[model samples]
Target: MSDYDQSPNYQRGLNLVKEMLGDRFLAGLTASAESGAFAADCASIAIESAFGAVWSRPGLARRDRSLVTLGILIASGKSAELRNHVRAGLNNGLGVEELQEVMIQAFPYCGFPCVAEAIEATIAVLRERGLIDDSTQSAKERGLL
Candidate 1:
């Protein structure tokens, strides 16, 4: 059912993300991707070679890990990636404020244009995942939101 299933590498990478993160977040990534956008080989490399191979390396804990990836992705203006990391960040214990802080930190070096875009994309991701909501209490109440 996932486009990623067509590529061994994609499947491998997806599994690796799962192993490092969890199934709920991986499902979210798979469900969010579009049709005909990524070929099997590319997906395989992205999933297996890129994430599976490099992301799980030593030197970072899983919680701090997504934050680093998220920082780089946002700083680099990778809108497409915002969805994946935004969801992973929250699932991995990142609060909305933390997300904003990361974006803001990227601004001094990455510039307003990228920060603005990342804010839009990351906020949309937060909204879609129910990480942002009207029912959400004040920042003090949740201690983060």
Candidate 2:
């Protein structure tokens, strides 16, 4: 609290996000939570206050943010993170096709190998979440047939 420029409530929320996402990414996003960059402020504001306040504002839904963030991470070749955001995307309202589009868009730069592994990861996530009857079923469900 005090004059640390961060509220107790905000810091607690950031800490909770750290628990959910773990140190590696929280570090990645916040630059080790050391610097005072936008990421740090994002850790301070977005994850903490805005996440509870402005992000939850009346307009865009959390699902929308997840989908957009998923696309960004995928395009950036953050395959390790694709599954989490992909799963969140599905939960938030994305379907197989939407997820596929995200992967495909990354192909020009990320290449087939990354996209291939991304497909596998995403399919397994969907299957685990029961979003698809099976991996192949996704195409049929989307009429990609």
Candidate 3:
């Protein structure tokens, strides 16, 4: 284990990531980071800073943070990151409708293509988790539309 792996912040970040994304995520991230020095450094920083310093802050709930992160990722057209965050959002207590609404709310500002990609990524995550099926009419349910 490295110094960071023993640090309180790193431990907290690792726990937080595991709580939200599960152990498999960290495994894949660790495997990828093992490829080179730069990637390892970057992963350490992200785990310590992004997950520990920012995510552990008391100002916002994890669900709220997930929403903001998803919005930014969507606006930036970061589909891959969006997919990961969609899972995080669900784990953070966001429902499937809320996830869809986030994309819908971003549609006007982020444009069709960006929002479309985000929705597709979100749906993939939802499907992976078995949260939605082909016949689910989520938009119109509970007057969400």
Candidate 4:
């Protein structure tokens, strides 16, 4: 293990991430980071800054932070991050409707195309979680059919 892997900041951030996203997701992230030194370094920075520093702060609830992160990711066209945040949002107690509303509200500011992609990413995550089905009926339920 590297210094960061043993640091209190990294450990705290990892714990926070696990609490927010669950052990399964954190395990995958750790596996990915372990593939390279640079990946490990980047992960350490993300853990310290995004999780330890920002997410661990008070004032905003995890659900609210998840929503805000979703908005930023959607507006920036960060599809991958948006997908991750979609799962995180749900984990943080945001219902599917709330996430849909976030995308709808972001449309004007982020543009239709950006919001569309974000919606697609969200749907994919929902489907993966078994919250939605891969059927025309399910698509219609979400107004996508």
Candidate 5:
């Protein structure tokens, strides 16, 4: 076992990440850490800080936090992270309509291109989960079609 394996903060973070993301994704991260391809310390810090410290904070609910995260990720064009958060958002009780509204709200501030890219990423996730059909309904609803 790694030295950080038994650390309270790391364990808490890991548990929180598992709750938010699921075992398979967390296992991938753990595998990366164990292989030394990705530094365990970095993973530990991210889990502890991002999940345990930040995400575990009070005031904002997990669903709301996911919304905020989605907006920022969209604006920043962080498609990969956006994909993860889109799933996280849905798991946290954000519906497809809510997520679409989030993208719509970001359109002005993030610009058409950014919002469009974000929508594409969101659609891919929704389709993967079988939550949506291949129609352009979402884009039309958002005034993008």
Candidate 6:
């Protein structure tokens, strides 16, 4: 095992990540680590620092943090990470409407293309969780007769 695996912060992060994102993510990390891939080291640092230290902080609730993360990810065009956080956001108690509002809120700051990409990612996750149907209406389509 790596020294990181021994740290209390790493353990805390691992547990929190499991609670937030489930076992598949950790399994991917483990597989990468076992393969001795460089990305594994980066993932370890994120797990220990981002998840363990920052996410474990007391000032913001996980749901609030998820919201903040979604905004930043959308602005940065981090679609892959955005997908993961979309799932985490739902797990953290963000409702479908709240998630949609977040994407809408980002549209002005992040622009249409960025927000559109985020919306697509969010929609995919929502569909995966069966939160929305395949025929789910678009925003404009929802209100018009």
User: Which candidate number has the best lDDT?
Assistant: 6
TM-score of 4: 0.85
Tens digit of lDDT per residue, candidate 2, span 54-79?
A: 44455777667766677667666666
* lDDT tens digits, residue span 5-115, model 1: 666666667767786557875665555453435553454456656776566566777668888888888788887777777877777778888888898789898987777
Model 5 accuracy (lDDT, Cα): 0.83
Q: Give one digit per residue, the lDDT tens place, for model 3 in 1-145.
A: 4566667887788889898898999877665545566578778777878897899999999999999999999999999999889988899999988997898899989988788778777877887899888565433342432
lDDT of all predictions: 0.70, 0.63, 0.83, 0.82, 0.83, 0.85
After superposition, which runs of candidate 5 have C-alpha atoms over 4 Å from their true positions?
1-4, 137-145
Listed in order, each prediction's TM-score against the native is 0.68, 0.53, 0.86, 0.85, 0.86, 0.90
Regions of model 6 farther than 4 Å from truth = 137-145
Compare candidates 4 and 6 on TM-score and give the better one.
6
- For candidate 1, give the lDDT of residue 123: 65
Give the winner by TM-score: 1 or 3. Answer: 3
> Which pairs, if any, clash in model 1?
9-44, 10-44, 13-47
lDDT of 6 by residue, 104-132 (tens): 89988999878877877787788889999
> Between candidates 3 and 4, which one is better according to TM-score?
3
For residue 18, what is the lDDT in candidate 2? 58
Best model number under TM-score: 6
Candidate 1: stretches off by over 4 Å: 1-12, 19-38, 134-145
lDDT of 4 by residue, 1-145 (tens): 5666766777788988898888988887777666675577787778767887789889899999998999999999998889888888898999988988998899989887788788788888898998876762433366753
Query: Of 3 and 5, which scores higher on lDDT?
Result: 5
Residue-pair clash count for candidate 1: 3
Sorted on lDDT, best first, the list reads 6, 5, 3, 4, 1, 2
